[model samples]
Target: MYEYKCVELRSKMFGGALSGDKLERVLNEWAAKGWQLKSTAAVDVKGRIGPGGTDGLLITFERQKG
Candidate 1:
């Protein structure tokens, strides 16, 4: 049988305005689940760390062969 899975990390300008370090942490955790950072997307809401703005990120994880 074939199995498939996915993980998504979203921070709507909360968690202290998501930073690369924090994002990396999320990526690392998911990485353990065989997930890797694939891509990311974001939009300006109002402002953020530098300026409150909305943001979105996409991560892709896939099973590997042994």
Candidate 2:
């Protein structure tokens, strides 16, 4: 069975405001890359890899079988 997890992403840096639907669209795009859609509840984190504290949870296709 596939599993899901929560995710979070910032907007201001992306140029446009982020919406829940937008996040879903992202999730779908990510699914194409093999990451399953888990959750969208994101918390705040400081700093960033790019402009606008750009960071969020990514997905993995293979579960750790723990």
Candidate 3:
């Protein structure tokens, strides 16, 4: 069996921008906890922006259930 986890990366967490280094650190931390990245999605806060002005990233992860 497998377990899943979801992490929300908000732009505001990095002063309104998501930096690669910061993201890597977060991912690495999860990896240390035995979670593997599964997928990612850009989440827009509003529909009127036409995919612009994304609020953050939705990161999905999975791992074996021990």
Candidate 4:
């Protein structure tokens, strides 16, 4: 069996550009905890002060649950 996790990566730039450095950091952090990236999906995520959503990525990870 395995466990799965979903993480949202939001763009901090004004022009809606995703940070590569941040992405690498998150991937490494989760990998250190035994999680491997399974998939990703581009999405528009709702923000705290926004009427519409912003561009973001939905990252999925999986790990053995034994």
Candidate 5:
């Protein structure tokens, strides 16, 4: 069995950069807790302008059930 986690990255919070020290810290923190990255993808956040207009990132992680 496995467990999963999702991390959302917002452009406003990250200044449009996805990979950074903050992200690394988060990953490391989870890694220490036995989580591993499974996948990542660009997500389009719905905005006032239109759908698929806002840039975002989605990080998926998985870990063995304990």
Candidate 6:
């Protein structure tokens, strides 16, 4: 069987774009721990004090369970 992990990535800048560098860093970090990318999805996450939501990414990873 396999295990999975999910991570939510939000833009650091307000009304700006998500950082490619940040995404790469997270991918590499997980890779180092033997996790392989499973999938990614775009989503709008609601904020604490807003009627709207913020753009974000839902990253999923998987690895064989030992």
- What does candidate 3's lDDT look like per residue over 10-34, in tens digits? 7877888898999999999999999
lDDT of 5 by residue, 1-66 (tens): 999999877665676665678778878988998999998888875655555556777889999999
lDDT of 6 by residue, 1-66 (tens): 999999887664324677778788889999999999999999887767869778889899999999
**Which pairs clash in the backbone of model 2?**
4-38, 5-38, 5-39
Question: In candidate 4, what residue range of length 10 has the lowest lDDT sum?
Answer: 12-21
* Alpha-carbon runs more than 4 Å astray in model 6: 13-16, 48-52
> TM-scores of the models, in the given order?
0.49, 0.47, 0.82, 0.82, 0.70, 0.79
lDDT of 1 by residue, 1-66 (tens): 323444444565346467888877777887787654555545434442575445555455555444
Model 6 accuracy (lDDT, Cα) = 0.85
Error of 3 at 33 (Å): 0.4
Tally clashing residue pairs in candidate 3.
Answer: 0
Score residue 35 of candidate 1 by CA lDDT: 55
User: What is the Cα-based TM-score of model 1?
Assistant: 0.49
**lDDT sort, best first:** 3, 4, 6, 5, 1, 2
Worst 10 residues of 5 by lDDT: 45-54
Model 4 / residue 59 / CA error / Å: 0.1
Model 4 alpha-carbon drift over 4 Å, by segment = 13-16
Candidate 3's C-alpha runs over 4 A off are: 45-54
Model 4, residue pairs in steric clash: none
Provide the lDDT at 58 for model 4: 90
Candidate 6, residue 19: lDDT: 75
